[model samples]
Target: LAQEGQFRQRSSSCHCVPTSLSMAVRGLKAVALAACALAVAGKVQLRHSSHKAADSSLHVGSFVTPLESKHQLRVCNAFANSAAMDVFRGAESLTAETPMPYKSCRDFDAPLKSGDKLEFRLGDASSGTFSVADLPNNDAVLLLVIHRHDSVSGAVSFESHVFAALESAQVAVIDTY
Candidate 1:
């Protein structure tokens, strides 16, 4: 009788070992499947958000100066009383009295000073120009110059979040194309 009882105990223990291994394998498979599902869901969410951002329009207010007109102004660096050409853009208006309406660079020959405030027009309106004096006052300025071939469907692209951060920190951005 005792031998029969011992044999029954050994048989039950052997059966339990296989059952526990099977349960562990099933648990591992379930965990793997859950991880895969989470990864797929994350990728889908990322794709959706990117598509939405690309389709959205970013409005940068009326501070950008779009150089679409024929009027041009060149910003030159005068070193040792000699001017080296730095940047050139379409000058809209310096003031109410002096409005730049020249068609070519040869026609407009006015020199620019360091602290000169030149008002330029972007799209269809006037925009402000930032200088060294504006920096001392902790004023933030966003300057965007769109080139002919550097636009998407005639619209200039920029990262709005980065500009927002700079605006929040009072750091002026002078973007030139």
Candidate 2:
């Protein structure tokens, strides 16, 4: 009887270890699955936020005329609230009828004036050389012309006008690659 009872105890002890090991493996698998789900959700959220930001920024590549879009920005110094340009681009002057693409770095409470010579250029999407020239007939705005002379295979020139800066001027950047 004593021998038989010892044999039974040993058999039960061996069974208990495998059952414990199986439970441990099941718990580890559950944790790994949970971690994977969290990672995938995070990636999806990141992509969603990026797309949202892109929608708001202006795309300089999409518009043939920069002034035609709502994203047109101009930077300049201002007076009583009316724009008074000192440094005009693509055009020597501005008018209510002629819409120019630009943004001002100064206070928006005043008007935009481009009196200062502001360093300006089209963003990287430009493919051609843009020249700022004078038109004899129109003194109100400078004539900005894009020439294909230095254009690579698929590039076009775009221009922005700066107007109101007592000392300096700047354009607002919408996006970067």
Candidate 3:
């Protein structure tokens, strides 16, 4: 036969080229495990909708007492709200704080009066909106609203030690992220 049918058609096309490269490496590992299980179920549904919108926008007499020297504070980021606002001021005025580890706190519908001039919309869409006015009608502001599944290096190492201990007690740190 003509050279044994060309050696059985070149050994069945070299065994279908390693079985088509092992089915394209198992279809690229099943599309990378279904895109890592849909990115861990969209970060667990954005951490349960940012803990139910930070327990209904933190209201326990909306405490505010932390100002030692951020040069009499004023931070801005007022309007394209996805989540990420960390404005802390502390040098001495603290009546009883420490209860905000991150849970969507920026989409103010209305009702945060005290020379209200807050508007920060920056979660990450090429960040844009920002407006913060002179907020120091007797200092004591600590608004730390960060979302997107927080834990960004433990909220930037606890806001970089609360912005270097409120800039070494110069206290006016208006950070709008």
Candidate 4:
């Protein structure tokens, strides 16, 4: 009985749970942490989204046909600091923005057929994203892929806005055929 009375007295002096302000402060901290995490994820998602592109142009056939067996092709690659990727139709020429040459993935979105004898201009050195044409400074290397779909003469073909990207500490030609 004495011990119970003493314990009750001791606990009676401390008649406090967490204060409302303290709880509110903790809730604010939790919300801040959640926001930070979401911001980071959103940034990552944006970068990844850049790497992808949607089909904007219709493949009506090429304005010019491939007269020679080998078509002059080029692709604008930015695979070194940037990942240069584009989906093209009737691709006779490609240009590059960086010096790094990308490994060929015939159809980035889809698969390549037997008729698709796409040319890939690889870097003699650095196996990275490169383009053939260097706009201001000679930096990009272009991949010259051959794409020819036989149709009527008065036809036009081009890939839609089929491109997206993700900036990374390092981005390489992970997939190539």
Candidate 5:
């Protein structure tokens, strides 16, 4: 308790403390929280009043059920050669903004709405731009796999495979030639 008080006092009043890294980390956390809040707000707005009323019946401590109405996108990095892979969502780099990539696998997942075009980059190796409307409506989840391919012409390429369950659908194989 005494050590905790000292830490609080020093952090609150000490001007000589070098806390730039910690401050930056805190700022990034704030940004991420704000983004999450905005997403929740958007979902709330889209939901009907009947849904809201139905939600009130559930116990307070119970887990909220996830809505599967929106199309789900899962980007997987199956490329074994690269030490690490970076993923980008639009102009913002998803891997760069999130701290989870450093501790876990380099992958991204998001809810994509119909007619919304999602563009992403897989480091410098591969990139793709596709709309939710383009994907088959039969599958709820769209899997985008980043993989390596060695051509007979002594060329290395990154191919993206869209998978529905165990079946592979070759939608786009972008050549970085």
Candidate 6:
């Protein structure tokens, strides 16, 4: 009778652990679902900092257009308030009237030269303006868009940074067995 009681107690305790684990898993699923719903509804806001790339060296396989050569502009949309962005060069829209989505990047086919002006628009509102002269004298240029949202006043602001890299020397190809 004593051995039977001990076996029953151990079995019951083992069953209780599984029950607790199931409840914990269910709770986690519920939280994940709630977060997904918020993102789908566009209620979630993203905040990012505009910082230059840590490694400035151009990789061996990567190519960089010389400063004297034609240049292309790469824009990264980090703005979270709106779903998409519109890029304008003066009165012309570079994105062909389609807004670039948030957290996505676009490369403009048109070349950017010094003294050129670029306007960043979110929906119908203009977020910020950037000048080509703001970029460094490096071979390639990347435009990073950073934004700040004011919850109190319901306002949004944007800032852009230029990350450029210089052309590195070509690595000599050596045939090895």
lDDT of each: 0.31, 0.32, 0.32, 0.31, 0.44, 0.53
Tens digits of per-residue lDDT for model 4 on 90-153? 3542333333234333323222222343232333321222122211111122222222122333
lDDT by residue for model 3 (1-177), tens: 000000011122233235666788689989987986777677666655666654745322212344443322222232223344433222221111331123423221222333333222223222221123223332233332222223242222112101222212333232434
Alpha-carbon shift of residue 158 in model 6 (angstroms) = 5.6
For every candidate, C-alpha RMSD to the true structure in Å: 31.4, 31.8, 28.4, 29.4, 20.2, 28.9
Candidate 2 structure quality by residue, lDDT tens digits, 38-144: 77666656655666554755322222222321112223321111322232333442332332233333221222233322222233222222232321221122213
Question: Per-residue CA lDDT of candidate 1, range 117-175, in tens?
Answer: 43333434433232312211111122222122243333222111011112123322333
Please, what are the lDDT tens digits per residue for candidate 6 over residues 74-168?
66666665558888877889987577887777887666665666777776777766655544443544444434345454334444333334233
For residue 87, model 2's alpha carbon misses the true position, in angstroms, by: 86
* Predicted structure with the largest TM-score when compared to the true one: 6
**Where does model 5 exceed 4 Å of error?**
1-68, 97-109, 113-133, 151-177
Can you give the lDDT of residue 103 in candidate 2? 36
Give the per-residue lDDT of model 5 (tens digit) for 1-177.
000000011122333324785588689989987987777666655553336564755322223444344435555554444345565545656667642222233435554555554443435644344444444433445554444444333222223333333233333333432
Which residue segments of model 6 deviate by more than 4 Å? 1-67, 136-138, 149-177
Provide the lowest-lDDT 10-residue window in model 4: 1-10
Cα error, residue 123 of model 4, in Å, equals 72
Candidate 2 Cα deviation (angstroms), residue 72: 66
Candidate 3 lDDT at 101 equals 24
State the TM-score for model 1.
Answer: 0.21
Candidate whose lDDT is highest: 6
